[model samples]
Target chain A: MESNRRKFLKVAGISALGIAGAKPVLNAFASEQEEEAQHADVEIRKNEKALTARQWAMVIDTRKLQSEEDLKPIIEACHKTHNVPDVMDTENAEYDEDNQRHVIKWIWEEEYKHAFPTKSTEFLDDRLKNLPFLVLCNHCENPPCVRVCPTKATFKREDGIVLMDFHRCIGCRFCMAACPYGSRSFNFRDPREFIKDEDRNPEFPTRMKGVVEKCNFCAERLAVGKQPACVEASNGAIAFGDLYDPESEVRQLLKSNYTIRRKQGLGTGPAIYYIV
Target chain B: MLELTVKGSKKYFGWMALVLGVIGIGFCVYVWQLISGLQITGMSRDVSWGFYIAQLTFLVGVAASAVMLVIPHYLHNYKAFGRITILGEFLAIASVTMCLLFVIVDLGQPMRLFNVILHPTPGSVLFWDMVVLNGYLFLNLIIGWNVLEAERNQVPPPGWVKPLIYLSVPWAVSIHTVTAFLYCGLPGRGYWLTAILAPRFLSSAFAAGPSLLVLLCLLIRKISKFDPGKEQIQSLAKIITYAIILNVFFFFCELFVVFYSQIPEHMDHFKYLFTGLHGHGVLVPWMWASLGLMIFSIIMLVIPSVRKNETTLAIACIAVFAGTWIDKGMGMISGGFVPNPLHHVNEYVPTVPELVITIGVYGIGVLILTALFKMAISIKEEVAA
Candidate 1:
C-alpha cells in the first residue's frame, strides 16, 4: 500500500506541474488567435454611431456666397467651436488690420484677388471679382505642414484630415512657414486670455499660447456623427464628405460643378475646392 | 587648461563684467518673453519668423565656415592654415552655441524641446537640422579641446582624433546644407525655394566667416606678439574675395530668374526687399546699403596691395562682415515672408526688447569666444616661449 501511495503522489505532482505550465501556453495561443482575428488598431476608437470616411474633402460654393453678410454665421460657428481668439481685444474686430501681428484665424473671408492671386485678372467680371471667397486649411494630401513638423505634433489622419495636437507642439512655427495657404496661425500670446467666457465651447479643447493651430475640419463633431460646424452653419454653401467615395455628396458636388483649388500647380493636392 | 581663462589682466575682467551684465539683462527680458509670450517680439502671423531665426541662419553659415580652414589645412596640405584652424573650430563652437540659444528663444514651447528627440521623424528637414547642428557642435568641442590640449602638452592629438577631424569636414557642410533645406524645401516662400539656396548659403558663409577670422587675427596681433602670419591673412583675403564674388553671382542668378520669368510670386519678394512694395518697405535702404558694401569689399579685397596691407584688409574684412550680415543675416529670413502666402505685404521689424535680446545672445557668444580664444592664445604663447 505504501508503494502504491508513492506512485500516486508522483503522478499527481507531474500533473500539477503540467497544468501550471499549460496555463501560459494556452494564454500565448489565445493572444495569437486574438491578434490574427482582428487588427490591433480595430481595438481603438470604437463608436458604433460615429461617421466614417475614406478621405475628407470640402467644397466651398462661391455661387452660394450671396453677400459678405452670408459669411458671418459660418465664421462665427467655426471661431466659436474652435475658440479662435480675437487679438484685437474687441469683439467685432474680424476685419481689423491694426494688430495683424497677432491675427489668429480658423476660417475667414478673402477677396477674389487675394484668394486666387494667380487666377485673378485686372479686368475680371465685376461680380466674380467683388464676391467674398471663403478660405481655410486645404488639408492637403501631401501636407507640407505635416512634413515639416519635427515633433509629429501635426499629423494627417488616415482619412486624409490634417490635424494638430496642441499639447505636443513645440511652437517652432516651421509648420506655419510650410503651409502654402496661410492657413496656419501661431499664438503670439495666451489664447485663453483673448477668449470670452460665453464664447468658450466646452466640447472643444481650448488652446494654449506658443502652439500652432488651424482648421481641423470638425473631426470632433464627425466622431459624434455630425457634420463640421461651418458646413452646418453655411446654409448649404459648404459641402463636407468623403472625396474617395464616388456616391458621396461631396463627390457629387465635385462632378456637377466646375471647381478649382488654390495653388494647384504647387502639387500639394489641396482638398478645399471652390465651386466657381 | 581652464586656468588659462582665470588669469587675465584687468581689461579681461572688465570685459567679463560687461558680458555678464548684458546676459543678466537678457535673462530678465527672456523671462518676460516666457511669461508674456512672443507678443513681446516683432514677429507676426504673416512674418512668422523674424530676427532670432535670421541670426541663427547666419550663424549656421559662420559655423560651417570652419570647413574652409579645415579643407585647406587637412586635405590640400596648405600649412599656413594649420595655426588658425583651432581658432576656426573655436569660433564654430561659439557660433553653434549662439545658434542653439537663438533656436531656444525662438521656440514657443522651449520646455518641450526634447519632443524632437523623443518623437524623431526622419522625413522632416528640421529633425535633420537639429541632428546636424548638435553633431557639428559636439565634433568641434571634442576636436578643438583635444587639439589645443595636445598643443599645450607638446604631443600629437591621440590617433582617434584624426578620424573625427576628417569626419568634421563633411559634417560642417551638412549643417549648412540642412539649414538651407529648412528654407528651400518650403513650397510657398519664393525667396527661399531655389535649388541654389544651399550653394548661395555656403558662398556667403565662406565670405563672412573667413573675413571675421581676418579681423580676429588682426585683433590678436594687437594683443599679442604672435601673428597668424601675413601669408595666411592674404590667403584668407583671397578666399573671402572669391566667396563674395560667388555670393553676388548667385544673388544675380536668382534675380534673373525672378525678373526674367516675370513670376509675380518670385519677383514680389525681391521688390519688397530692394524697393518699397506697396509704399511700405523699411528694408529698402538697408538692402541697397548691403549691396553697396558688398561691391566695395569685393573691389578692395580683389586688389593685391589692398588685401596685403594690414589696414586696408581690416577695413575690407569689416565691410564683408557687415555686408554679409545684412544680406544673409537680416534680409534672407524676413524677405521670404514679405508678400506673405496670401500675397499680403506685412513687414516685420524687431522691437526694442527683441533687439536687446538679440544683442544679449551676441554678448554671450562673444563671452564664450573670448574665454576659448584666451585659452588657445595662452597655450600658443607658452609654446612660443
Candidate 2:
C-alpha cells in the first residue's frame, strides 16, 4: 500500500510537468490557427478597399505664373482656407518693409531680383522687369529645418510630405532660424483668437501659443487619398503627381522643362520644382 | 563674505554712482520690458538674434578676461598679479552677471527658461550655453569668494581650492569659445560659419576684454586709492598688443577668403557688413570704424613710446573695447540676417523698449560691479593695513 502511494505521487508530479509544458504549445497552435483565419479575412477585404500607394510631388510652371495676377488666387485661397487672419501688427511683420502685419502668406510673390541675385534682367522690358513667380515651401527630401528641429516636431511622412506636429513644439524658434526659406511661423499669441469657429479646419491642428507651426502639405487629406488643398485650389497652376512615375504630370514636366528651386545652390534638393 | 565700509572720511564714489540716480530711474523704465515681450526689440524672424545676444557675446568675452590675470598669477607664478588678481576675479563676476542679465532681459520668454533644465534637449546648443554660462558664473564666484575670504583671514586657501583656481584657467577660455560656437554652428549664415571663428573670438576677447580690464583698473584708481601699478598696466598692454595683432590677422583672413573666393553667400555678408548691400549701408560705417579703431589701437600698443604713456594706452584700450564691441555686437548679428538667402534685407535697429531694457540690465551690472568693487577695494586696503 505504501509503495503504491509513493508511485502515485511521482506519477502525479510528472503529469503536472507535462501539462505545464504542453499548455504553451497548445496556445501557440491556437494563435497560429487564428492568424491564418485573420490573414484570409484580410486578403478578402483588401480587394474592396483598393489601397493604392501614392507619393506626392508638386510642379509649378512659372510660364503659367507669367504675371503676379496668376499667383494671387492661389495665395489668397491658402490664406483663406487656413484662416490665417490678416496680421494686425503689420508694423512688426518680418517681411513687411512698413512693418505692418498682414496675412501670413504661404505663397510669396517672388521675382528675378528676389529669387536669383546672380541673374540679371537688364535687357528685359518694363513688363518683364520683375516677372513675379509664386514661391512656397519646397518640402525638400533632406530638409535643413527638419534636421535641426530639437523637438522632432517637424518630420517627413512616407508620402513625401514634411509635416509639423505643433503639439510637440516648445517654440524655441530654432526651426525658424534654421529654415532658409522662412517657411515656418511662431504662433506669438493664441492663434485661435484670430481664427473663427467656422474657419477652423479639423484636419490641421490649431496651434497653441509658444509653438512653431508650418505648412504640412495637408497630409490628413493625402491619407484619405485626396490631393493637397493648395494644389487642388490652384486652378491647374500647380501640377500634382508622383515624381517617381515617369509618365506622371510632375515627372514629365520635370523631364521636359528646365526647372529651378528658390535656392538651388543651397543643395537642399527640393522635391518641388518651378519651371521658368 | 562682502562687507560695506563707508567711513565718513573716505570719499566714497559709490555715492556718486548712486548720484547718477536719473540714469538708474531711466534704467527702471527700460526694465518694464518684461511685461512687453521681445516685440519691443529690433529683432524679427529673419534677424532672430540681435542686441541682447550681441551684448551677451561681448560680456562673455569680458568675463573671460579674468583668464589673463589667472594665467599669469597661477600658472606662470607672476606675483605682480597677486595684489590685483582678486580685482580681475571680481570684474569677471560682475561681467558674467551682466552677461546672464542681458540674456534674460533679451529672452522672449524669461519665465520659461528653467524648462531648458527640466526638459533638457541634448541637441540644442542653447541648452549647453545655459550650462556653460551658469557653470562659469558659480566657478568664478566660489573661487573669488574663497580666495578673498582666505586673504581676509591672512592665510593661504586650503590645498583643494588651488585645483579649482587651476581649473578656472581653461574654463574661462571655454566660456568665450562656447559663445563663438553659438554663432559659428549655424549652417546657412555664411558670415560666421568658419573654423577660425572660435580663435578670432578668443583673440578679440584677449584684445578687448583685457583692454576693458585696464580701463576698469584706471576707473578704480580714479574712484579709489588702489594703484595696480605701472608695471602691471604695461604687462596687460603688451598682452593686448599681441592679442590685437592676432585679431586683426583673423579679420584679414576672413576678408581674403570672402573676397578671393567671391562665393556669393559668404561674400554678400561681408559686403553687407563692410560696403553695404541692397540699400542697407547703415552698418558699413560702423564696421569700418571698428576695423580702423582696431588697427589704430594695435599700432599704439605695438609702438613702445605710445605704450609707455598712460593717456595713449588708455585711449588705445578704450578704442579697442569700443571697436570690438561694435564689431561683435552690430556687425556679427546683423551681417548674418541681411541679404538672406531669399535676397531679403531685414534691417535690425533696437527699439525704445529694447534700448530701455538693455540699459536697465546694464545699469544693474554696473550697480553690481560698483558695489562689489567698493567692498573688494576696502578689504584690500584693510589687508594692506
- The number of the candidate with the highest DockQ is 1
Residue-level lDDT tens digits of model 1 in B1-385: 7778999999888999999899889988999999988989999999999999999999999999999999998889998898999999999999999999999999999999978976889999989999999999999999999899888889988889999999999999999999999999999889899999999999999999999999999999898767788888888889999999999999899889989999999999999999979987999999999999999999998888888898999999999889999997789999999998888888899998888889889999999999999999989999999
CAPRI verdict on model 2? incorrect
- In model 1, the runs with Cα more than 4 Å from the true position are A1-43, A91-98
TM-score of chain B of 2: 0.95
DockQ of every candidate: 0.62, 0.14
lDDT leader: 1
Cα distance off (Å), candidate 1, residue A88 = 2.0
Clashing pairs in 2: A87-A102, A89-A101, A90-A99, A90-A100, A90-A101, A91-A99, A91-A100, B30-B356
True contacts kept of 1: 0.84
Off by over 4 Å in 2: A1-57, A88-98, A101-103, A118-130, A146-172, A186-213, A219-226, A239-258, B5-36
Docking class of 1: medium
After best superposition, candidate 1 residue B211: deviation in angstroms? 0.7
